[model samples]
Target: MATVPFPFSPVSCAFSRQTGIRRSPLVLALLSSSALLFPVQVHAQQANAGAEATELTEIVVEGATDSASGPDKSIVAGRTLAGSKTDTAVEDISASVSVITQAEMERRGTQNLDEVLAYTSSVSADEYGSDDRYDWVRIRGFYQTSTGSYLDGLPMRISGFTGSRVEPYGLQRVEVLKGSTSTLFGLNAPGGLINSISKRPQAVKHGEVYTTLGDEHVEFGTDFGGPIDDQGIWSYRITSKWQDGNNGADHTEDDRFYIAPALTWAPTDATSLTLLPSYNKRDGNTAHGIPYGSGIDPKTYLGEPEFEAMDTIEKNIGYAFSHDFGNGLQFRQNARYTDLDLTYESVYGATADPSVSRSAWAVYGNSRRFVIDNQLQYDVSFGRFDSRSLAGMDFSYNDTDEHRVFGSASGINIYNPVYCGLSCLTLPAGYDWNQQETARGFYLQEELTFDDRWILTLGGRFDSVTTESAFPDSGLSYKADDEAFTKRIGLTYKVTDGLSVYGNYSESFQPISADRTSLVGTPKPQEGTQYEVGLKYRPANYDALFTLALFDLTQTNVPYNISTTTQSQIGETNVKGVELEGKFALTDQFNLTVAYSYWDAEIVEDGITGNQGNKPQLIPQQMASIWADYTLPGEGIFGDLTLGLGVRYTGASFADNENTLKIKPHTLVDAAVNYQIRDNVALAVNATNLFDTEYLSYVSIYDNTAFYGDGRAVRATLKYTW
Candidate 1:
């Protein structure tokens, strides 16, 4: 789940201690690693210990779904919801799931998948204006980049830590399913999983445009979508966006153009299909800023122009379909094809020099990926039990070839005179990492309801993966095949009106592969488990929902090459946490939403001796966020004005398991004001980090060093509808 280096400009702040730990880092890593294998989960019977003595509710919230039976808009009716229910007892398969609404995305002006998931439990996404459009996000103590992502329950393309990439626009919601999910999905990382729901056909006609202006030649452009037919059988949406700006730091300029077009067709009452096509051409100079070891002050952090960051020219085409057979069954399918041409360069120098960081040879790579997912579901009744059953399969192939070249150290340049561009041309552009991988998988799941009161869900999956990387040293290639099976089981009970409780147990697996120059033995398939329980309450006659959940997760058989350094989870990991999220519409003009999380993660094994109780890098123990908005109900223009506020906080963390380095905790506040110019237009201004607060969080690690997140940023937008 680790992300490759991208175009992030660190503030001039430097903080970390090279001081050695009194105990062995390996020992501590191992002890902590064991935590990944053994976790204490919360179950229905234990609910009273975590909170009050609670029972189950009668109804649950239902989100939008396509089926042969068509679609229905039914809100929650005082029952346990899908996101947070804890009743039937197992482990963590009943884990909590959080959804980021489309409304929230616009308020934050999020440009990609990475930016959109930032405000969730167990999620830490850092996008401090690095060169690449892609983002680096952490969940449950593991790095989840392009590799650890999904679109509508299907995997996307992901390679190792080389070239950088980004997600496109036109998404309805980003759903975060915490903990192991291989039970229904297949071949996954243990940290957690992400499911991106694309924008679909709607009966209503809707579309919008947005424009923005900021500092350092900053600018923005956007266009939205709605309905395209009278029968409401067809729908279309388009997004056109462009950005040109200099980051808050030096040598950082974000420039790009993007186009996304999506369509949905409902030829019959029982069939629906959607097609999405996207293209993006991003050209910018790469950025390599100060490493955390130098202790550079983020305030003084302007970057050198020498390192070539991420230069990628890409295209994406995808299709999804849903069919309702009318026998209480539905089918779904998703497919995506991608093409990528990218080049990257790096400058490695002593931490002290602001200018000569490029000392070694430059690195570059090129790749392409194709993936397809198909699924079928059936809903039926058996005497006292009603069920929704699913069967699915997945397949993916990646063909990537790298080009690397050597360059002289004296060629390093820190300014606009031009280093190599982000993505290509560092050395001679022919150097090779030389690797390829292929994988295939299948899975099944079922949700059962008994006497309209007891609900049970069960699922399982299997995956086959093969990897090959060649080493030029001995003309030898190391290869490995990883095959695994995972399962999920949970129960939910509706014991009373307006309340429901649930609990679940889930498992996951990750395959292994080797590169030619690889010395890491093909590891056993990584294994993961999750246990969770929670309560959901929705009062009748009120427009509000509340949920509280507790979860414990662990992963073992992780990938590691003792010959080099142990990455995020080389051995085992244990993550336990509690989360609370709610939304309240107090009145016709006032609304509020709050999300809070507490996480405790530790490494259980490192093959070394003695490092335990150490917090995982980038995985803060405590995190919280809240937002509110209110509109004045008046007779004139004053009634059109709305005000909003948001805040997020994180606890302190150690940069590494050895605790040789440390990062301070921080909080951010944002304020917003909006006025409706008329019925279809509005102007909004937002001030983030209004106090100009300055701080840094962990990004990634190499050997014994750490990197930080971005500093303060502010943006405003003008929107119009037709």
Candidate 2:
């Protein structure tokens, strides 16, 4: 295909600063007061960007060789760039955004977000996605949750312990941005973030469904889609899933179910809109780490499962909306109303001593949250200079209403350890609690790109939050806090055709309610600053990209205690690190992606050890992964067969910041095979932890304190697409 470049001139919101034509002095609702909006721009491309247009491609999940079946290629459909607001190539975005294509998930038989990310370098998710309890992926060592997530540029979540599980079948792609992102974005954690582009109306008819299985009793899931119109203006997609499974080492079980629906509207050639409404219900046990004491050999439990002694449940409903007003103008609104009835109780040593583990009291609670967000933006033009600016406000008020219900029974009757297997009985009862926490925030951001080759970004935000507790007739105990404004700025320069260089400066402020007063003390805001430099390279001739980065960051004012524990420098620390990533299509039928990272963190100014040195618990100093697939086209009655392989390596880590406990590094591998049966149907098989490796995610004992990684297992999937 000859390169077709639709290059345009640079236009910006610059003169507006003096003319004040479209912006107001007061940013009414957005938590921030500034935003960078890019409403218009020109053409883009290249391997090394030598004037050749890049080929657009989609991943194959059904293992089909025909690259003709993808959302973007549909006769009638719109597109999105969730990683950036402008035409910035993925390799030039400054921030690292890991792209998880829909094909990648289907190819791996992924049932959850964690499964798809397992093979991604720089990403480590909770071992299983069987339920909502521990399905989180860590990027650069920070947990990616509601605080680190977005759907079509709108906030997708709000808390960590309680984040939403997006079904793999309902997304066009998953983009992960590493490092501080206070610019062009609002209130967020400095640990990095994830953006999920929802599946929308395709203006055409299209859809598919696939089911999978594995060890630990794992089973059930399907994803399907289609059009809702003939004028090519609307479309709809649905995803549903359920499973009963077990994680390795503790006799554990993963069980849960969920579903989601979405609608897309494209009224004309220059504009588009999307709406998504989702609901999920999950119930399952958590990872059973060995008790604090009573040393036991982790080897003896290698085949054991993390027992389901503890249980939990969750329910949520939410809607997301996004509109692109051609010419660099856009807007978004997200709202959610959630009511949860849950009960959590842990039997300390269910496997070691069922009686003692079961005897522990269970704590139960019910929680409710309501959140709404609105943001607006417009892109303008300037004669010699062009800038993408955004000015909008967001108000998120979470009324976390929680109350304790009662306590549950302990593990008893099974005094002999022999009964600890799946045969164990007489599990303990559960309990609940009642409490409430409220938080509100406002923010804004702005970005400027010169000649479409250089970008500068700036932004800030403020927040107010409170927490309260109520136990039956004891009235209530409440605490409130306010934080200072946080700021961030960044720069990116196109160094070569497919590569760019970038640097950033950012700050994060946290407000905690430890003072028991309206605003007694703010704990100095846990101030932090970072210095980083990186290279993003996407070869001009092939479908491949490589990235290298280094950074130094420091954090202070971390709380030391739960109540009245808001102290400054009690846990001050410094972190420095390096990272590398690459994605490429080896051939017309083969593709591969790889990533690696190294980090060094320590307490620089803390009470624990004046200047104690130790890596964060469960945080490996080194991590790497590779995923590749090969397919044979136009072959047998079975059709093209695609094979996939993945491997991961994790470095040493400690169980606590004190460095009292330690764990050595380990490696694991996975495999998969896919074959087409008919023009619209395909079959697949997937296996993880093929070797059933035994390694501890963290230290639990002197001789045997590690947890199991995963045991070997397999499942077959049948999928049909139109």
Candidate 3:
């Protein structure tokens, strides 16, 4: 967790909680409204800080033309808006963006966001081979949990039993916007999106504090920030962490606690405002796959170590605002509110027989969400052309309440036995229904730039959604609504100053579920379209960034389920891809990152004629990865060293859909090291499948289960900084 150089525009804020020591009345009204808005924003920043800094100093010099990394400071970034929400660059963005920073997650000691997108490219995070409790990714080949995910750019309300668990050291970067963004993010998942960002408030001061210990884990963390005075116009940050471990499966337990806090105030300098709060909790254990030629032992535990566990808690509070109204126009707003809670009980051992029978379940969930967005940007011109425009609106609401209780425990011995206890399973005296959803959107965009080497982009969006349900033990109620409109277009051609060439076309929509009407009729609305072409290279010398992309997407009305309450929008799917990425530093001590992807996802139209052209289970028609790091060059106590290495690959697919359960291909290797025992301490070590590779990270085929992929774990860290 390291960061600095933050001058606003990381738009978004969020957190709240209380349980055993008070707090939580919405975290005491968000800590009494941030202590009554912190002295009224420091008395309105000392009463208008000198007539708003002399009339906003020409609107801060026209907001420095929306600075797109003009004064180069590197961690590999040439500006971004996750591919055009404004701040362009990223080689003019025609698509396929991927950023990851915080110094590449502290030189790959990444811990989640699926190990910070293990080598990126078409991504395929935690493909379930262990490490459960959320964050399962998949991009170019679909399944981004739900609607692709986001944070600094809003949208992070998932459901099944609620979701969203971040804390990758409270992130400071992590983009990955790869295809069909629903024209400025409306209903998504054409395999793209994963924003994150957050880790704001900075005016120089920095910090870090860490502790981690391996093979069964243990953790502690802190990340600090600066200024609240000295007139840096108030700034602050805080990111916390605490963890307890054991994820080598057996008797699994993995606890956690996280916190995030932020603040910013800039009373002038064209205004700014920020505030964020967060809290997270977890106590994990869940993910009992196993039953693929079950020779058992993938860290076999088969559940039941005194009634297993999987608790959760989440809370967030947010804010983000911008101002700058000096002739170039600008106004922004962001919001957040979230709450989630879940409890799960387990009892697996689903197969390996023993007269087969061992499955108990329990889940009680709750969720609440509220989101918001508002934007308006301008930056116009005419005379050798130049422009940047945007308009926006967004809203979201959510409510989910769940309940499930099933029983039938006791059935051990896959090699060993276990004794039952929770009264041998039996729990159900209440709860079973609730759901609510709401959404809204309106978007517009335009980017245009001509003489400076052509760049054009267009966008559009309009959306509406609603969902409601209730069934308190069968008292029934339901509702639905829908609407959509999406579009996007792009073109780029810088062809110089570090290359660029691009093209794009996009659209996406998702609606359906209007009171669930479909037995082959009335529930239309999924939709997608894409076409892309790309090339970007930021070489000139080094500090690197490279890319190449080609794509074709397609999706349409997909829905299936034919009975038990009917569903059937028939189906359709397609994907065609290619991607290559690179991130290098090639010198100041070497660094590198590479990624590759292929993807061919099929199922082009199907109502079930043998699943029409199949090939879409776990998507992976190739993937690749590489990573490297180096540093060495000592002085004093022989310290200051660094090293890292990585490798990954995936291919092979079809775990069913009658594509005949094939699942093979695998590769893995990872390592790391760090030392620098003075200058504020350091010492690190990391490893992941450094050989104990077993493979099959996920394969279900309707619960014929599989999951394995995490072995040779190791960790060791100790850091302290200023």
In order of appearance, the predictions have TM-scores of 0.81, 0.79, 0.33
Lowest-sum lDDT 10-residue window in model 3:
11-20
Listing every candidate in turn, what is its Cα RMSD in Å to the true structure after a full C-alpha superposition?
A: 9.2, 12.8, 23.0
Ranking by lDDT: 3, 1, 2
lDDT of 3 by residue, 282-301 (tens): 78877766667878676777
Clashing pairs in 3: 13-318, 14-277, 14-317, 15-277, 15-278, 15-316, 15-317
Local accuracy of candidate 2 as per-residue lDDT tens digits, 1-722:
00111110000000000000112112111102111110110122213346643232323332222121123221111122443443345655556666666656666767667776775556657531222344455666654454566655555443313333555656666667676654445444555667776565454455666566555565565656555666767767676767776554345555667677766666775555555666565555543444334455442322123333334444545555557777778776666666554444333333344544332323344446666666666677686556666555555444333332222234433223343444433443322224454556566667677877787867666665554544435554544455567677778888776678998777654443334343224344445566778887766655566678888766665544323433333556566777776665545566666667666666554443332555555566666676667776744444777888877766666655556666666777888888777777778898876787766564333222234454566778777776
lDDT winner, 2 or 3: 3
RMSD score of candidate 1 (Å): 9.2
lDDT of 1 at 393: 81
What clash count does candidate 2 reach? 71
Highest TM-score model number? 1
Q: Once superposed on the true structure, which residue ranges of model 1 sit more than 4 Å away at CA?
A: 1-93, 112-114, 127-133, 162-169, 217-227, 284-287, 291-307, 348-350, 353-357, 360-363, 405-430, 471-474, 516-522, 560-570, 699-708
lDDT of 1 by residue, 98-191 (tens): 6665555655556556557756666766623242335555566555554567765556645643444454345656667676767666666666
- Report the number of the highest-lDDT candidate: 3
